[model samples]
Each structure stands twice: as C-alpha cells, then as structure tokens.
Target: MTGGTGLFISFEGIDGSGKSTQARLLAEHLRSTGREVVLTREPGGSPGAEEIRALVLQGDPERWSAETELLLFTAARRDHLERTIRPALARGATVICDRFADSTRMYQGLSRGDLRGAVDTLHALMIGVEPDLTLLIDMDPEAALARAKARATAEERFEDFGLPLQQKMRAGFLALAAEFSGRFRIVDGNRAPEAVAQDVRAALQAQA
Candidate 1:
C-alpha cells in the first residue's frame, strides 16, 4: 500500500493470463468482506493516465522507441499514483490494480532489450512505491496467447508481438516473483477460474 491505512495489491502476468479477471474477483471478494475496494489498471487508472494510455496502446508498436515509451508510462503512472491509487489508499481502501510497474519491467525489458536497470531506476526515482502485495497469475504461454487473441482489440500493440514474446514475458514475471518473494504470490492460472480465485484468496489470507 502507498498509504498507511490501505492494502494495495497488483496483478501481474503476460497478456491473457487471466490476471485482470483474477484482479476483479479479488476486488469483489474484498468488498464482500466489507472492505472498501478500488479496482484500477495501469497506464490508464486516472483520467490523465487514461489519455496517456491511448498514446501507448493505440499506435503502432514501433510508433515510439523503447525509451520514449518508458517515459510515457512513467508519466501516466505518476498521475495514476497521485490521482487515484494514493488517494484511495489514504482513505483506507483496498486497491486492486490490473497491472502496474511490473508489467513495464517485463514488457520493456523483453521487447526493448535489457532496459530493466532503467526501469528500476525510473520507478525508484519517479514513482518511489510498490504494491504491498502482487498476485502473479502463471499460465502456459500457448494458452494465454489463445486467450489474448480471442479478445483482440485496437490495443493490440503488445499482443501483436506473438507467442514467443509472451513465453519470455512469463519467464520474466516468474523471475521477478522470485526476486521479490516477500511481496509476490504466484498463482497457477491454468485451472478453472473458481479454482484460481480460491488460490488467490488463500494467498492473500496467508499474507494477512
């Protein structure tokens, strides 16, 4: 959590790994437990961030260089943190974010070549915070790609890169979980939605 009173949880995984669905389920579960929950997503959580999101997601994947994209993402995230996530946390609400900095780390590092250091530096200097808990939905890249393709939209900039990239992204995410074990929980996403949801709930409960 960015604030003292709330619990900030973020979902991370390759596109189509069901992280978004699980994020929503967790929010619903938390709300049912009488907690005030705010569900949001990266690159587009706050109004200003949403505008930045279109620039990043709508254009051709090569429209911006890796470095330029990173800056845009950071700017949007700063706005998201200040305008939406932080405020919700300060009000003692549980913030369930669909994606966050972790995606940038993996996506840019994988697609843009060895930019993890830059990503880390930018995040530490500009954002300076992280989710208290991150739920990583692990799944086979093949299946995940299928899922991603089924729901294809104009925001296919990243998805257009194809399956091999997705596999690498999954490996990157797993490595990240190991690196930040204290704040990450890897849940198997190959199972039924209910089963995955139960696992997520159990992970959060165990953390609690």
Candidate 2:
C-alpha cells in the first residue's frame, strides 16, 4: 500500500455465479504475493451501504421501482467510495469489489428498465474513475438461479426474476464487457470456482 497509483478492480455476474468466492480467492492470491489488497463489495463496504444492501436485495420486491432501486444503489456506492475505496486506494492498496457500477448498469439498468439517464448521471457524479479492471463472470443465469434457489431459505425479490429475464440479463453483461475491451474480463462461471479464480489471476497478471 505504498508509493504507487492504486488500482481498483470490480467483479460482476448473475447471482450464484460464484464471483464472491472467486473475489476472495483473488484477494488472497494478491496478498500472498505481497500486494496490499482490500477486498470489499457494494451495497456494502460501509455501514450505511450494508443497510442499503438489505433493502435492495431482501426487501419487498414488488414495491420498488427501477428508479428507486438505482438511486439506492448509487447512495450505497457514494458511501462505499468515500469511506472505504478512497482511503484504501490512497494507501495504494489494490481494491477488489464484488459489484460496482457495472452491476447496476446491467441488472437495474438494462434489465429492469431504461437506465441510460441514470447511468450518465451517476457516471458523472461517482468517484469519477472507473475500475482499472472489471471481471464480469459469465454464467447462464438459469443455472445460477437454480443453484441459488436450491441453497436459499426463501426467494428474495431479485431471485424471483424469471429465467428468460435472467438470460437477457446475462446478455446485458456480455454487451457491457464488449463495450469496454481490455479493461473488462469475462470469466466462465460454470467452471469450478478455483478454475475460475485461475482465469481471474491470469487476467490480472496480464495487466500487471
């Protein structure tokens, strides 16, 4: 965490795609190699953001609109950047986050409704920098949802989206990765988690 420009990396994927597991593994890999890493996630990484996370993911799904959801996500991101991301980066630590701006642009943006306006607004207002590297873990959303539902106590609002919509969402993620070339990596999430982590490591190493 000393003397160099900080690098910010973010992971994105459909639910049950195992990006969270891989993100932790990636953090450990970086740390073991003597890199200072801060692993965090959004709609989280801060107290206020955690509360927002519960509301966005676990609350009554039918009651909230697309705009409401987007605003809540950005609200959490603002806190996350100020409280955790900035400080860690200022120390030159590599910051890996579970989800960032891309998730909202995909899930709440393209999938739920037209969020082009919101995206533009937030892009202007956010930390004013994008991830140095973003991994959009690519997995079929149906497979992901099935895996998630099998392990769930109950369905959250997000899990209720049908398979067809989830597939569309997966397409949305692919489109995003295409929109940004080397800066984004799409990992095959259907593989074993460690195998996926290996791919992530390879991708990051190429950049370094």
Best model number under lDDT: 1
Q: What TM-score fits each model?
A: 0.97, 0.93
lDDT of each: 0.91, 0.84
Per-candidate RMSD, Å: 1.0, 2.3
lDDT of 1 at 137: 98
- Tell how far residue 60 is off in model 2, in angstroms: 2.5
Give a tens-digit lDDT track for model 2, residues 1-208.
Answer: 1223799999998877888898999999989999999999987999999988888887565668888888888889889988888889888899999998888888778888898678768857764667889998889787898977776754367877758767887888888899987689888998989899999999998888
Best-performing candidate as measured by TM-score: 1
Error of 2 at 82 (Å): 0.2
* lDDT by residue (tens digit), candidate 1, 1-208: 4745899999999989999999999989989989999999988999999999999987676888888889999999999999998888888898999999999998885556788899999999999889999999999999999898899688878888889899899899999999999999999999999999999999999999
Q: Which stretches of candidate 1 lie over 4 Å from their true place?
A: none
Residue 136 in model 1: lDDT: 98
